[model samples]
Structures are given as structure tokens and as C-alpha cells.
Target: MAEIQTTTLIDDLTGKPLDAEKAHRIHFSVEGKTYRLDVDEKGADEFHAALDRFIEVSTKVAAGGASKRAAAAPRRASAGSGEQTKMREWAKANGYEVAERGRIPAAIQEAYAAAN
Candidate 1:
């Protein structure tokens, strides 16, 4: 048998942090197994659509009006302006070291994501 599970900070549909204590949980089973997960605002986007579908199909989670976090969706840098270029500029401006060429470091990416 194999199993996998993890938890991430739950958020509301608007991307605001949600109180774990007040959050609702959904429980269901598939293939002779059971699983439970808390409603998360950020869990239903395209990134987690497969899991969302799995949970939805196997349970009545949708009937309860839970919504996926939509505010965390990656913003597309305006066409021609580009996020990479902006990221490079922001790093330099903030005194964060960046490669002159090639992929930006993950730290930089995280910072950039948090900023924009």
C-alpha cells in the first residue's frame, strides 16, 4: 500500500487567510479507502483541479458551497512587459543577487511572487 497526504495553510475564496478553527472539513472515500481534507480557498484552482475533481466526484463537497481560493492565481505579467524581466529588475533594485543570465533562484521567485 502507498499513501500521501499534506497540509497547507487554508485560505478563503478571496485569498485571505482563513481561521483553521472555523474552517469546515470534507470527508469521503474511494477505492476502499477514506480521506478527509479541510476546505481551502487556494485548493480548487487549476493547479489542484485534479484533486478537486476527485474529491468532488467522490463526495458532496460542492453541495456545501465551498469555494477555491481565486486570489492567489499567478498574475500574468502584461504582454511585452513580461514577469521575468520585472522580476530581474525588482531583484536588482532590492539588492538581491541574481544571475546575470539563466534561471532566477527559487528564493527570488518566491519573493517576486509575494511582491506581485
Candidate 2:
């Protein structure tokens, strides 16, 4: 049987650290099981569309938001323009998954590496 894991992806939708008062729980299923996770509620409804888009694109790119942003910075500094576009394209072509903060989820990383 396949193992089941739950992960929470955090975003500063309001440009600030998340507070418990404004959080939404989103559930996703893996291997026929369901997992519930929380998201910032401040922009839960308003940013849902963009968040969804970001997740979809990130899944395909296999890069985390922070890593992508970090990776793009140097390029932008050197080129002085359009670093985001370049990074996105580079990630897509490389089959990377974008994570919310560039840091790999411990569970996911462990599972992938069989470290646990």
C-alpha cells in the first residue's frame, strides 16, 4: 500500500505572517486518502484564484516559491529585467516543483528520499 502524508503550504497573502484568526483549511487527496491543510484566510477567497494558479504552475515546475524567487534574483540583478519570466520558463523546462517557500516539506522530502 502507498503511504499517505499531509502537508501545509503557507503564503503571506496579506504580506504578513499568518494569524490563527484568519486561516482556511484546504483539503487534498493523495492515494485515495484525504488531507486537510490550512491557508491564510485574509486572502483566502480573494487570492484563491491566484493561489490555485501558483500551485498548478509550481507543481509543474518542481520549484518552491522562495527558491524560484532566490534563483531569479541573481539573474534579474545581472540582466536588469524580466527575471521572473526567465525563472518560470527555466523551472518549467527543468521539470521542477515550486514549493511555497523554497524549503521542501519535511514529510515530502522524507518520503521522496526514503529517509524516514
Q: Rate the local accuracy (lDDT) of all candidates.
A: 0.64, 0.49
Model 2: per-residue lDDT, tens digit, 83-114? 43444444445565644344433444434335
Q: In candidate 1, how many Å is residue 61 off?
A: 34
lDDT per residue (tens digit) for residues 1-116 in model 1: 99998665454344555567655555655544676755554454433576766657664554323444546888544324366788889999999988767777878888887887
TM-scores of all candidate predictions against the true structure: 0.30, 0.23
Among the numbered candidates, top lDDT falls to: 1
Name the TM-score of candidate 2: 0.23
Clashes of 2: 10
Q: What is the Cα-based lDDT of residue 99 in candidate 2?
A: 48
